[model samples]
Target: MPPFDQTRFRLPRGARADAVLAGGVFVVVALGAEGQRLSHGEDSAPSQIASWLLIAAVCGTLLFRRRYPVTAGWFTVLGTGAYYLLSDIDGPLVIVPIVALYALAAQGRMQAAIGMAAAMIIGMAAITLAGSSDVTGTAVFMLTGWLVAVVALGSARHSRLAYAEEEARLRATEERLRIARELHDVIGHNISMINVQAGAALFRLKKDPAQAEEALGAIKASSKETLRELRATLGVLRRVDEQAPTAPAPGLARAAELVASAQLAGLPVRIERTGPERSLSAPVDLAAYRIVQESLTNAAKHSGAGQVTIRLAYGDRELALDIEDDGQGSAARPAGSGGGSGITGMTERARALGGELTAGPRPEGGFAVRARLPYGTTGKPMERSDR
Candidate 1:
């Protein structure tokens, strides 16, 4: 059995290929066996006209072989069995059975193909003993060997298709999660800051006009920046023919930008870092940036804190981050609560890199988030100017 048949007569791709090739095989067999065997004298002779018509009927079913493979396969097996029982001719009329069986299995009808295989083997064994004078088991063995090979090849094709489909599904799922995380980082943080600054701008408008103007300016800047990042986030899904932005991807190097936004939103912020500075792997860097972003977002939105401190401490084996806000100490909600994706996204990111994260209210006061991430292969020593 040929695993692939590239020797083509330019038959159109799908069902037409099966029909044309199978029809041609039937015609060739018919021409080669011009007449039936004159065995057991004229009394037992098979009619030439009847044999040709039976072969035509079986070959015609192959037209729908691809669309209704199981039905076509069964029809071919039954027709071939009838031909063996009735005809006194013996030639390569078995090619139609082989093609039908392959179609059924290659289309993932394993049970149907196996059933046809069993029927073919049984029919051949019975036909060997009844049609020929040779009582030896040689004919039965030979027929079984060839049919088994054809069935196996078709089954292998089915398995390969199944594996490919499963792989595609996994990639699609991963892409969806990646997009979700980007949205949570880009939209959530900026929206929170805008909400705060807009509220402050309105509250202080009459009492302190200059302070109100500053808050309004911060709101405008925050909104514009949000829109820019939103565009960058969505650019990932653009088609090949569409134009996409060429902005650098956000990571730990951009942490200071996040702090500046927080300050503009009327939340005083301080940063402390104690480390031999190094570069980080892309996934780890993005995760680090997102975790810090989401944490600051939560403080500005719900913490009710005036001051927030962000501490970054690096060691030989691990990197540690601590974000604390002197807020209402878990009075509002948990980090990822209120249908928010903040804590969920951060947790997934940390676990993916064999790291861990935790967030809760400190015993004395305020809310704190701590994350410890492995340096692993994702980090390397770099110059201070790299940032």
Candidate 2:
């Protein structure tokens, strides 16, 4: 058994075509019926039979109007016109063409459909006027009804197409955002650590060979971590049908791993939890993890910083992450510094999810990164006076 698709509700094109073809046949029969009745000039059996056959053929074509709407409309119009001109049938013969015209307006090209409708109205008026009968009521009813049907159905089709296109665009946008978030979580974290350790290694290479080697080892480790993460994220971007080795990317639960890695790279990382220890929403947790990772990276880059403390606090409505490093605080740094691309990217990530991020040096001495996210309306605050 195949999975049911809720979206597949449209009438098949072929089915509509068949219906239109049937309608064209009916138009011819209907005209013949009116001709026979007029020839007899009385309520005769032969005339009645001809009219019934014609009505059946024209009505049958109604089923296929959607599939070959234009063709059916044109045929009905021609057949109806011929019937009226040859048979002297009254207003009822006009109904077939009016119906076909409406179908055309609903599904055919707008300019052409409108033109056909105009022609039908004009032809009907000429016939009625030439016959010198009071046809204003019938003409108005037929033309108005056809125009309304066309406008309504055409507008519906246009709206449906627009909605489908919008949905497709939104899905694409979401996929891109998801990929970007994953990349920031993976490569951004590793690059920060690697850049810091490499800078430290270069500084120590000539002065202290042993320290240089240690820093170099840290750089290698960070590079490997970055590469692993990059590979995993890219794999997620691959098509499902494409064969590739897949690895899961780290989420918030891997904060301990990130902290351990930072510690190994000569940065002392202290992880503190102030909120009731509980699992967080995936997005919130991912955001919290990235904030800490970025702060640790900044610590390694700016100065020979040690003792970095990361605190996670959860309140009833919001989740807060704070990263503090004992590096040169805001006072130690020059003004107009540190608002680089990395900070800009981090800010974008937080704001995209309706979160807020603030970064500055602590007054006491060191840099601080803080992010607040509204995860859900539940959770106890982790009580911490000094983190």
Candidate 3:
């Protein structure tokens, strides 16, 4: 059968014995006929015809060998036994019994294979004794070796399929865990900020009317912003299997909106842009935006500071962004208690984009958060030493 044809039948280890037995029987008859045509020996036609008929019966039984291997193999042994009894010691049909036994061993039922093998040995011995045949000892050893090879090959194929299936399952499990982690990192901080804003709105609603209205407005705005970002990040994860989303993901380009949100939250902020603004890699842009957003958020929560400075500068090999707050500066500021993973998450985001983050109290009594992200836009920022 041709390889790659899905529908083609294969001879299993049990069935292959029958195929060899059938095919060997035919070849024996053909060899006998050729011997007679060459007139090298005096062979009787009736005996030759009987031998051919015996082979046909053995070959015909092979069709049922896969279904009834025991029956087919028994019939094959019986026919070979009878042929050995009738035929004389010669070159033509001498190899048929050994070949049939091999076939039975390769493709017959286990008990049937053993029984056929025993019968083949006994029959060949009987013929050798009665007719003084040559090569009788060689046939017995060849049959035993063929059986072991077929079983080993089939078991190996089974083992390979099992291993491949197990590996695929593990890969799928690891992929799911990775997706869960990314979701937690992307959505966790934003949701917490929303909760904080909403809680403040509810607490101030009764005693301070104007302050309560402002807090409620901030909550609404924060919720809307959180929903929008969640949708975008979810969209990114969903299209990861195919293509990145057609719409560009939000990044440093949205820094103005971030500053406005901080301003609305009653944090006085000054923003300065240096060097010509240009597009950056998506990962770098996203990380820069997150660093600025989170830094501003922390300043509003922990430091009762009125003034914050955000500076963006594009350099030849890197982009530098700094968000410094002149608030009650200290390393122990409680922005969101100890449960905050925001700073850690921001650092990870920057590192993922091949950038660095530095956040600590500045020596001059303020908290300074700086991130330097490499840029490759063919031009450098205007060189000057200005603070």
Candidate 4:
């Protein structure tokens, strides 16, 4: 048989849970009180007259334990002690205190639980050792064991809840960081091109109307691309049931458009491919595209590179991406000092997919970004089927 799926018990939480638990305990104790009444002779009606009422009081107070664990625990424990002092019966009613102790411990009230446990241990010892008492050492041992088990269960429950909450928080943090990187790459690249084109349009507005018109066209194209990419990047935040925007994510297949936009931004970029071009997974393709985009943008903005080159090489076991700029390189903008979110974002993208990216000044000149993404586990990329 298949293992049972335990996720079914991850029930919605609220006060109703407390009511259900308290009601179940109430039924068990009510039955026990009935049995106690039956055991008594006709002459002892006084002791058994209101016993069920007392059990009701104990279980009813426990309903509030989830919201006020410490307070409810004390009320129930004191009620049990009172019952023990007045009643001639034992055993069946002991579950009342055990349940309360478990609640207190599970709620993370260690001090209150410890106090109640000590009180019960002392009370049991006193009552058992008193005149003509027949309770044996094994009974005491069993009671002690039950108390320890109650505390252990509660502590384990508290620890699991805390750990699950922390795990959720960490997942949220990682998701936000990933979104931040996407936003940085999209906005930073497009806005840089837009800014450059706007400047060109302003410079040529009176001197050369044709050049000014062309610059404005580039600005329009870049603006549209920016909005589309922005929507795609932010669409992950939408509800799962909601329909996402139709804009597709940027990938290596559209890399030429990125190079064209860079050229219009006053930096000439040449893109090349080696080995047979094959289809890559969407995530790897997006990462590779963004890496090239950021490198080209950085070259235009900081390095003042007149010419940049992007190379995509497909291997039997891995895909390699190289970006090199022929600008002043480290001389114009020193390595690591050109500091911004660009390189860091690129590095994050690479590492997220178990790849490594290295970027620094070349031995001869210019800066180079080289990334190696292994694909053996995923197998060699298959050739894209043409329409």
* lDDT computed for candidate 2: 0.67
For candidate 1, the 10 contiguous residues with the lowest summed lDDT are: 36-45
* lDDT tens readout by residue for model 4, 1-387: 988898866764577777777788888887776676667633255656545566778888877877777787888878887777776655276787789898778878889998888888877787788843646667778888889889989989988998999999999999998888888888988998899889889999999999899889999999998998776665557745546666556888788888888877778888878887776787888899899988887887778787898998988877899999877766766545435577888888899888999898888778899998765355454675443
Residue 181 C-alpha lDDT in model 4: 81
For model 1, residues 4-91, the per-residue Cα lDDT tens digits are 7677545576866866777797887776555444333342434656667778878888887767778888998888777766666764
Clash count list over all predictions:
1, 15, 7, 0
lDDT of 2 by residue, 335-373 (tens): 333444456556766886688998887788788888887
Superposition TM-score, candidate 4 onto the true structure: 0.86
Model 3: residue 33 alpha-carbon error in angstroms: 22
TM-scores of all predicted structures: 0.86, 0.64, 0.49, 0.86
Score candidate 1 by lDDT. Answer: 0.81
**Model 3 C-alpha lDDT per residue in residues 51-132, reported as the tens digit of each score:** 6677577666766756765665677668766765675434344344344344455442346555655666666566556656
Ranking the candidates on lDDT from highest down gives 1, 4, 2, 3
Q: Rate residue 94 of model 1 by lDDT.
A: 76
Computed on alpha carbons, the lDDT of every model, listed in order, comes to 0.81, 0.67, 0.65, 0.80
1 versus 3: better TM-score goes to: 1
The segments of candidate 2 whose C-alpha lies over 4 angstroms from its true place after superposition are 1-136, 205-213, 241-249, 266-268, 302-307, 325-353, 360-367, 377-387
Superpose all Cα atoms of candidate 4 onto the true structure and report the RMSD in Å to 1 decimal: 4.4
